[model samples]
Target chain A: MHLYRYEENPLITPNDVPPHHDGFEVIGAFNAGVAKFQGEVLLLLRVAERPMSDDPNIVKAPVWNPETGKVDVYEFRKDDPRYDFSDPRVIKEAGAERFLYLTSLSYLRLARSQDGRRFTIDDRPFVYPSNELETFGIEDPRITYIDGTYYIYFSAVSPKGVGEAMVSTTDFRTVTHHGMIFAPENKDVLIFPEKINGKYYALHRPVPRSNGRPEVWIAESENLLHWGNHRFLFGLREGKWDSARIGGGAVPIKTEHGWLELYHGASDDHRYCMGAVLLDLNDPAKVIARSERPLVEPEADYEVNGFFGRVVFSCGALVDGDVVKMYYGAADTSMACVELKLDEILDSLVKV
Target chain B: MHLYRYEENPLITPNDVPPHHDGFEVIGAFNAGVAKFQGEVLLLLRVAERPMSDDPNIVKAPVWNPETGKVDVYEFRKDDPRYDFSDPRVIKEAGAERFLYLTSLSYLRLARSQDGRRFTIDDRPFVYPSNELETFGIEDPRITYIDGTYYIYFSAVSPKGVGEAMVSTTDFRTVTHHGMIFAPENKDVLIFPEKINGKYYALHRPVPRSNGRPEVWIAESENLLHWGNHRFLFGLREGKWDSARIGGGAVPIKTEHGWLELYHGASDDHRYCMGAVLLDLNDPAKVIARSERPLVEPEADYEVNGFFGRVVFSCGALVDGDVVKMYYGAADTSMACVELKLDEILDSLVKV
Candidate 1:
């Protein structure tokens, strides 16, 4: 409830990204994962690209074909009812069996800042789909710096499903893929900076195929290749705002109290908001305290309008002693920054 | 159109299957893939089962959990508008974004037939999902016997997407899993038994993420594990019975004229029918001819009145001299058999 928004908010938008081609335009530049690397603040910006078409009846989407080893295009006639273009960010196949696809192709683009306020974006894409498993494109990257290495875990999108894939960089310039860490039916994975109890721990959100609700889960790995010991961490609180789904945010920060985790939750209406949860320092499976209400909601006009309206989702955050600097995507379109006192958030928390 | 339907149709139903437990009931015993092995005809019947509850407002689906090595059940209340129980067989999530789930769990069951009409179905299941790739269940299996080995290719469903997986059985008792042969966003696979031009080829259907259209594709594999060289085979014929989607039916028969293949097609209105296509013997990718009209359609009451009405899908067929014995699932609920002169089908197919 006590947060200060930056004066020059909406730091990055479509105008910041360089054009890929003549017919394609950058539609969105938001949902960035933040980190402090090489004495500079880095934001892994999600850049969305869509084809510019003159025909009012047609909409085009970019496609990556691994079979042909080329990038192709899809043109959909607006006159045909097969497509649901209600949300500007994504297009849904309007049929008995639904297939929701993002209208524009999204890939990770790097933006760096000296003061963590103004950023200079790179012209080339940082991460894109290079294989069939990533045909849709890579998105929502969460950077975890552990043991002198920066590990980026991102959501690999394809027609198959969304899953978490890992890539590591020692110097931010040389990136190396570590293969798909988890298969389909997984997302919103955030790894801790160091191992807990001699085992690497990560917070994940697994969508249950059964009747169980979707919630945040914690898993441990000895080698980081084979993960097991999954336990539910945070769940939906019935008859509440964050009662539908909860996901892990950036890397968890260890404090004297416990491991502090800033998470995102959504209601049944799909309105996303930011919340906080505290886990036991030794056992993250044991949730200590949780926020009773949302920390950040869609209140500003920039957060109220654009691509997908009424959504304030955070991918990463930095805790500098008392001040919690958070970078969140506004309305699923643009990015903004906010800072809140750590005591104010902990005071707002309720014992769970 | 000269095919003769057997008088004793709908040979197997849910009532014929032995109960797995007292509380549960078999919902469907249909879509059997046919094969002749060890001097007897075999039917790989898809038996679907669901848990029964005293409460009329709830529906339950059984899930095999590999983690716990137990069958977990998902119970959904009818009052929850989030669940759509429109189609009796499948329960759909009815939000703006939708996903269809089978109300009952399905697995392949073996039914032995000495006379090819009356069958003694085995009490135990033949094949079900055992890994994460097949979390949903395997469906619509096609058996191709090559070099004294029976290969079973089936549709593997999960939350990720639908794809094809392969297995082999030397004695139909000990089956060997070959892992997932194809990735997600694909199905309707038919593998040719022997190698053509020193390569094992298969007919596949890859649903394009783009707007290109859904059509049958051909791929070649050197070791049957790594497949490549994909080529488009047959596509939909607009404004006709087979105007929407077409998939491979059985293994292509080696005829004197060429390789004759019987396939299944569906119209936009979900009207499923059967058709035939001829490919060059040396080059299976080259289509020599195609059926101008449907070979078998849902015209009878048995075909139009069961689960998933107005559907007739084939999984396997056999060729003995000039006669073709074909087994198909009607309305996705019950199986039936028909016989046709092979020459008659070839004559019906016109050069395209």
Candidate 2:
């Protein structure tokens, strides 16, 4: 895989601007979405911000107060038996509700570029959650273009569950929310380029029956709102490097061979990397071929250790002529960009 | 799934004959292995014998030529490509060298009880392959146990890949040949009384890959030969039911669930089935909660239709405790058998 980075690496960082409220440290600024709009490159970034406190014994985290429709912060002792402060992502207690430091709500920020490099970021957040369900944060935004509509699908996390929601915008500024497209406890939703035959098709990660681990599923519908004919696409390759979890990444592109999709997978150790797959054009449920190698990984410092470690996540990409521009979050703390030749990536796939 | 039986239900059925060539048809009914000690219930079947004819038109219908080690059949009126004279159970021409035909041989037969229930069969083959690739025409045959070392699996085809082969014997006694396992190039070999996690395990069918159709892949591997991975575990489900092709039938016995299997599915049309998988203890692969599904299918079928069809097939089930019995034919002609157990089948699964 060819990776072309910006002359100035870490295109987006924590110091670029404070993510949320004051007195909070902003980190984990990584790529959330990347697109070419009106000749200018646009990037949606996920910035992890946490409260700045000096008390060594105090651990404050954010929690959605459904009753109040506001985020609440609670402080727990470092040695509290009920709380597991060992995990950097969340601070949870055995029987008590889980929470992030109230100062940690994430919002999407915008960054614009002219030559697909050297970006200028906006001071304010481009999007934010308005209700308690999304009070914790809004992360991983993926952009898709259909006809003349630009659809932005993102992960909305809250106490209820991790769900998928969509927003459409023609000019970035004025956007219309499409509510939640998927039910709670689901994420990694990627819609196909065009309707198959005449029905809309989408690839989603569903945790069925709650007993088995997450697996890929295909859903179809006449309209995007009502989906049916759910079928299992493929499951995680057991005993392989991606034995843990898998999710959708860049929007699927229509190709002569099939529907080319870039997806992310994690091992038991939580090392995130990107892979590809080709699906039958007429029946998106059929997998034509899949990649045996990852397109990207957490090799840089910003991608190795940060607010979290060993995470290289992408929410979007732009197809320019024969090249693809991908923007990804590295180590959960910084944003980076890479260029790949479409033909080269496809050539790397392993046909069994 | 609609099932069509020949004019004879349990067609080419099982019969009780003292182990001997005069008593049955085709033979040498067993998978390749050396665990041949202990009492084994083998099938003795009849090997179909067609007298030579002098007429060129009648002689042109596929005939197993032992001297040349290939089927000698004439393509009358080569100009009209849509000719359909060969057996539907096998033989078809897609294009050029891609001709699909039943690789007929001999077959393996089973023993039936006077009560139409329990039965005692021979332990040796009444017949064996006349050639190399299949020095053993022995095909799929299912087996169940009444006591110790009692096992059976059959499917006997001819070495010339034209007729069926059946073989059977007890304590290596007067062997009997029942006939062929099926016709030729046909297989979805299955044995029932399914087991798993300390139960029985059966084998079944699934089609092979062709013109974009799917192929059969087995799961169970207790001692390494017996299987339980459910056939048709992967394939394309288009606009029509069984649109892709499928095979293998009934189900195997394993613990609580019984193992169910079938042939592969060719797209719109094409392909063949074979192989097996394991099922749950009480539920069987039929319940589907524990088993994967369809472990095999026809990738090669001689007579999938006509007097036969896309080849490769199996039927009948005999169990010896947790051990399952399976019988099947290749290209619709030859037969063979393999023994498997519930514990062994469950251990071979690549669980999701």
Candidate 3:
């Protein structure tokens, strides 16, 4: 497959924003929602703030000490079996629930661009984890345009697990949080471009049962809040390069081929890459064709080494004509963008 | 995952068969049709045969010499880029369908035992590749017993691609081939034990598009010959250990929980292992539950190093009371057996 890399790759870096805590860094800076608002390219970025220490020699690490109502340092060991400091996303004991210490806390940051190249980011986080379940973070924001309203779907992670939540804004400053549309342990919630057969269609990743692999499911609703007709769409690849896990990335784009979607794939090693699949426009659950090779991989220094290594995660992309401008998180530390001609990518896909 | 190896490990070895053909190894041997016939356990094994040569200079090894009408041999190097002999089942070009050299030739072989322990194997091959498309070999046979008749489903391979074929035998001696049931570029065909909702169901692995990952698809039939209603059942796990490829191993067994089935998984490294899944009894296509960890893996020397290493393949298993006797091929060379208490195995599965 012919691949294109940005000249100024690793466009976003770890130093872009300082961490809120001492032991973590700010990561997962992505465009949660994007649209032409007020005659400008507006982007809602999910900037994740995590603990900042990478050294194991420093036994004590800073954490949000709930009991003390302040950030406190706790002592752990380099060889501690209970804590897996090696993993950037999760840390846990053998029997305990996996906890994420560092995540892109749901703060809807703003960015503006004229040529869609250089973006000027807002100084403050736009949105924060308001609810108890969202104490951990909010992540992977997908923007869907319905009528004149812009709906933002993001992942809300907490002790309860990750769930899909939506918030809408007509004017950037005045936003209306729409509560959780789907249950917990759900993410990658992408709203279909338009209503299907007079019903709102959305693609969601729900971990229906604990300890089981997560799969893509579809739900329909008369209104956006109450969803029904829950049907399983896709599951993890059993014994292939993608056998590890998968998640919804950018919002589904409607094209002549179908609902084109760019998705992220992780192997057991947690190396993240991006691929695409075409879903039947009428029936979003029906997969038309999918790409055999990943559209984007972790090849740059920022992508291969950071808060997390070998990760190329995207939660939003903007389609202009036949080209798709994708903004992604590299190594969970910085943001980057790559452009692909939609027709060329679709043409490279293998059809069954 | 807690794994238990058979006490009498490596219960079957390559030396069990005659060694005249310079390692006429028994590989891809599956339980095709097992029955309590004439006071003995009759098993149809799909034994894969290949000549063994120690030479490493000549890269292109001939499997069958058409001019001489005999099996031919050649040499292959581990460092050769044009041909990769790394994969045991398939050794294809870097990104092409052309294979390096034929390393295995599959044919059906018969074995019988009065006590399900000590067995007697027939010296002659029962089924061999007949057409040009099936010149490579046949492998992974699944048998279904319906109305006092035995029907066998197996993979037929050639330069064209791997496809599923059917054959029937009532008394072992008189066999009738049913030609190809599925088109080329497919394998792991398994027929449901009985009709569901007045229609026959079968599970097949199809690579409908080249270079794309394989997926499980379901088909329905009225006469068990012409199948329709072909629909997607499941895809491989993305970013997991078994995220690469998956295929049906043994025939589905009827249970109160659902249609219990043992399936095989391969990682990107091509290590094959066994797992179980439950499908809705009434709707055989709906997956009810699946095992998170593999029930069996290649650990022993015979299982880790032989004609192919790190492989444990199965096509047949017999349930007696609450015990399931799994007959599997180890390291693509010998037949081995493992006894699993049905309820214990079910306990390990993730219920959905």
Stretches of model 2 off by over 4 angstroms after superposition:
A64-70, A95-103, B1-352
Estimate the TM-score of every prediction. 0.61, 0.49, 0.48
Per-residue lDDT of model 1, residues B203-311, tens digit only: 8776543233456777776666545445557788889888888888877888978888889899998899988999999999899999988898998777887768898
Error of 1 at A322 (Å): 11
Candidate 3 per-residue lDDT over residues B104-147, each given as its tens digit = 67677677887676668777766666554456666767778888
lDDT of 1 by residue, A116-222 (tens): 88999997888777776577778888999888888888877766556677888888887888666644446788888899889788887755332334577676665
For residues A169-288, could you state the per-residue lDDT of candidate 2 as single tens digits?
A: 888887887665654445678877677898788777754220234666666655454343444576677665467888778778877888888888888888988778888878887898
Better of 1 and 3 by DockQ: 1
Two-way TM-score contest, 1 vs 2, winner: 1
- RMSD values for the candidates in order, in angstroms, are 8.2, 20.3, 13.1
List chain B TM-scores, each candidate. 0.95, 0.36, 0.87
Error of 2 at A313 (Å): 1.3
